[model samples]
Target: MNKEVKELDLIIIGAGPAGLTAAIYASRAKLNMLLIEDAIVGGQVRSSYTIENYPGFKKVEGGTLADLMQEQAQELGAEIDEFDMVERVQFSDSEKIVETSSYIYKPKAVIISTGAVPRKLPIANEEKYAGKGVHYCAVCDGAMYEGKTVGVVGGGNSALEEALFLSRFAEKVILVRRYDYFKGEKATLDEVLNHPKIEVMYNWDLVDVNGAEFMEKAKIKNTLTGEEKEIVMDAVFGYIGTEPKTKLFKDYINLNPQGYILTDENMRTNIKGVYGAGDVREKAFRQITTAVADGTISALDAEKYIVESKRVK
Candidate 1:
């Protein structure tokens, strides 16, 4: 089958905070931009229930914030294409090629903001109970388990922090770690451990999730003794880690060992006219604010690249 090809000034791979912000800047700059997303326009922010950290609003729902961003970007003349998954990226000397499931887009500049995917547990029935009583984002599904007992998997900063946040609503939170030691910061570790509603279980790994319709219990195994035990719980939240979604760019761009795209302060990758933003890029922290900042930087940098390339011609 023949593929439809369209030329664009700029192409953004995500519709999240970073990508939307980038689109806003690019549109204001009068650049013809295309924003593509595999799911909804809001990226991870849509999954969150409440956002208290984002500036401007005292407190707001994540879906609402995402909707506003989408509207603003659209009003600025940025074209949004949701549910379109990018299949591959081919970088040439002058133009970057983005092939999605529906069409092929050629852009003078490309901003990668694919973001990260949630990590999952490798236990039996864990996948079965997903969205039933198992969740990954505390900001997204934390409220559903309110006043109920839930289990959090992992001991890293994300796990510890989410457990602390869930404590506000949940009656009890069980924090289970595969290792005896924690990888999170000392201060966060101290706070999670000191919380009375949070229970810390060392050297325990989730082996199974048992329930009739929703999750009711979790089967855990002791790493050292090989003993198995079941913990009654209302829900399970896994925060092991995040993996970057950069498989399409692996052969075309320089990426870190963990598959995160490598970009400079200007959000430019090693290849010219190609930039990265959001959680896909290497950074100290991955948050809505940070991703938005990345989007702004990438759009400006892309504009500069476009001007310079025209000058050389």
Candidate 2:
């Protein structure tokens, strides 16, 4: 364990939109803050192809948008460390200690914006052919399957949205859903139903993926009739749901039933000095705009806490 003590007024875990936004706010306020991210700076946004929904910009590449945010934060005096993975966080009324794989941090406050991981299929060989043929973000890998047939699994909004995105590149998109009914909005359902290249296969659960190097075929079991069948496809995408990245905080922070961190409106967690934000926190929506809002709130709260602590000292 590295013994170098890197102390700051606040530490924001994750360099995604939320974390970076927090860094911007804290740094702009002249608060001594640090932003840490073990993964890529932009989080899931970097994997996206073209993001049109984000404010200000009509259309921008995901990677480009992340770069802009990162640059802005750093220019505002936010220190971003991309090497360490925060493994544990110990909170107290006076100070908060964050332990990562490489170093330990004792910041006045911590903002946990670790984000969430995509839920994957439990099928065999799914991990083996991850990038080869198995994909999660359609916007990230849809171009790879240009004119090729692809399989999409899910019954919710994410699945349907990705299927629509995939339809632009793939000649045929097979929608394999475990339930007969779609759980997405009516507008999306109508669009999917009217799509010519999309074949909606309802009540089907993906069981296995057959591929030597990449994906070639997939085996799915029908939930209603208990029938199984194999279909050929160049690639498969899973978007069932997301598991919040809160394993480290489970024993410490308060979480909801699905393991998402529980935070109040101010982004304050059960602990006073520790705050939750972005997708990692339980909220109604998980979008870039909302994440930015969460980060802003967390940073402001951290700044206020630090000022009060100084007064108490």
Candidate 3:
């Protein structure tokens, strides 16, 4: 039997901070919209242990913040479908079609907030010891290495945050950075430097991981000198960077060289009715606050487009 096609004024993909924020605005505007999420509603924010930079709170749990956003959108009459995978999408200036496992949606406009995925460690045997030792999320895997030593790679905000979070569980944390300077915020850098549990290594690179079934030791090399050494560790956490989650929309939308969607200041894409927001779009910064701002702009612009279309009709 063929399922009935659902119709909406706007379709928001990815229920992350950006998508959820869009849903809130769209619902407040009394627009008939649907928010679809393939995995959990919070996206990568759910993986974070704590968030201190977001406004209105000194420190809040990542999962708690996501839940609050989800509740706000739901209370405002936003229709959300969680865990429904988007099988296909057809976008144009006139209309947009989104196909999922549960329903096929035809909406006047679409807002994409698919976000990004963590960049993998570029070291030998890293994939072989993925869950066993090598991990991208410290919040998810830090508990397993309680009282044991772990190594963190990268010098950005993500690496600093993960190292701080891991310190609560791991006995020792060796932070490795290829450059002498840190790319993270000075506030975070201060905390990382002051933390006794963490040992920061500058001008060093992670070369390899060695083990039979799981990771036992990691090879490190000094960038300045031609010296290499191996350090025994229970696990390795990588927070190098992230790549956009735009594989499904790459062919249809205009993307940058790095595969991120290119959108205007108002979040409008090359296609008139389609918009891109959050980490999936090409932008300098990818913070929760910036993503929320993007979501707001995209929702307002999409609302304008939908209203104008109705007026023209």
Considering summed lDDT, which 10 consecutive residues are worst modelled in model 3?
A: 1-10
The lDDT ranking, best first, is: 3, 1, 2
Best by TM-score: 3
Give the candidates in order of TM-score, highest first.
3, 2, 1
How do the predictions measure up, each by TM-score? 0.83, 0.90, 0.98
Candidate 3: the clashing residue pairs are none
* Cα-based lDDT at residue 309, candidate 1: 77
lDDT of 1 at 26: 95
Q: Model 1, 228: alpha-carbon shift in Å?
A: 4.3
- Checking candidate 2 for backbone clashes, the offending pairs are none
Predicted structure 1, TM vs. truth: 0.83
Candidates in order have lDDT scores of 0.89, 0.89, 0.93
TM-score of 2: 0.90
Q: Between prediction 2 and prediction 3, which has the larger lDDT?
A: 3
- Tens-digit lDDT string for candidate 1 (33-137): 899998888988887666767899878888999999999999999999989888888996666899987789988899999899977877778778999988898
What is the C-alpha lDDT profile of model 3 across 1-313, one tens digit per residue?
6767988899999999999999999999999999999899998889988999999989999999999999999999999999889999988787788998767899999999999999999987977999999999998889999999999999899999999999999999999999999999999999999999999999999999998898999999999996999999989999888999999997789999999999999999999989999999999999999999999999999999999989999
Model 1 collision count:
0
